[model samples]
Target: MRRLALAAALALSLSPLTAGAASAQTARATASRGLTPAEVGTWITGLGGRVGPVQTENGLTFFTVTNAGLTWAVFFYGCEAGVCGEVQFSAVVPGAGATLDKVNAWNRDNRYLKAFHTAAETPTATVQYDVVVLSGEGVAQLADPLAVWLQLLPKFAGEMGYVAP
Candidate 1:
C-alpha cells in the first residue's frame, strides 16, 4: 500500500513537468508559422548581437545586425500586407580587390551563399544568402542558416581582400 502511494505521488509530481514541456513545445510550434522581423531581431539580440532600427525602402524591409565587429543587413522580401516570407543576409565590402575571377571562384566554391561585384564606379564585393522563411520553421531551424552566415562573413571578407567596415 505504501509503495502504491509513493508511486502515485511520484507520478503526480512528474505530470506537471511533462505537461509544462508539452505546453512549451506547442507554443513554439504555434509561433513558428512564419518569420517576423521582431522574432529575428530578438534572435539576433539573443546571440549577443546588436540590431539597428528597422528600416523600409521601396516596399522592402530590412535592418542591420552587428556581431564580431561585422555588420550585415537582413532584408525581407515577398511580403503580403506586412508579413515577409523570405530573408536575405547581405554584406558589402568596399573596393574592387575582389576581381571577377575571385567572385566566380567564391560562388563556385561556396554552398549557401553567392558573391558578386557591383557595377558602381568604385566597385564593391557583395555576398548574400537568401532563405525562405514561410515553411513553418522554428527559431532553431532558422538558426542553421544564420549560423552559416555568421561563420562565413569574416572569411568572405578576408578572401575578397577587403575588410568589413
Candidate 2:
C-alpha cells in the first residue's frame, strides 16, 4: 500500500492534465553549432535571419530576436567553463501583445540567464515587440532553457491560435 501511495504521488506531481496543456507543453530542440566566442560575435556571423549579437550576461551572450517571414527565431549564445559557442536558430515567443510580456517574464525567471536588457525599438512593422536580451551561463548549462523557449513559442501559437498579432 505504501508503494502504491508513493507511485500515486509521483504520478500526481508529474500530471500536466491537472494544470492544462498550456502548463504541460514542452520544447523540442537541437544544437548544431560550435561557434567560438569571437565567432559568435563577428559582425559577419549572421543567423538564418538578421538577428545580431549585441550583449552578454555572465558568460551568456544575447542577440536580437528576429522573425523571417514565417519563422520567429533568435540566437542564444553562451559559454561555460573552458568552452564557448553560439546556439543557432532558437525559436522566440513572438511578442504580439500579451505574449511579449510572458516572454519577458520567462527571460527574467531564467536561472541561467541574467543581465537582461532591451535595445531601442526597431519596430518590425509599426508595433515593435520588445525583444529582451539576457546573459547567463553557457556551454554546459545553457541549452535547455533556450530550447524550452523556442519550443514553447511555436507550440503556444499553434495551440492558442489567438495571440492577437
lDDT of 1 by residue, 58-163 (tens): 8779999988878889998876655677889999877768777888898899888888887677777899999887546655666889989998988888887886
- Which predicted model would earn the best TM-score? 1
**C-alpha local distance difference test of each model:** 0.83, 0.40
On the 0 to 100 scale, the lDDT of residue 113 in model 1 is 86
Give candidate 1 misplaced runs (Cα > 4 Å): 1-33
Highest lDDT: which candidate?
Answer: 1
lDDT tens digits by residue: candidate 2, 44-84: 23424454545666754555544323343334444544233
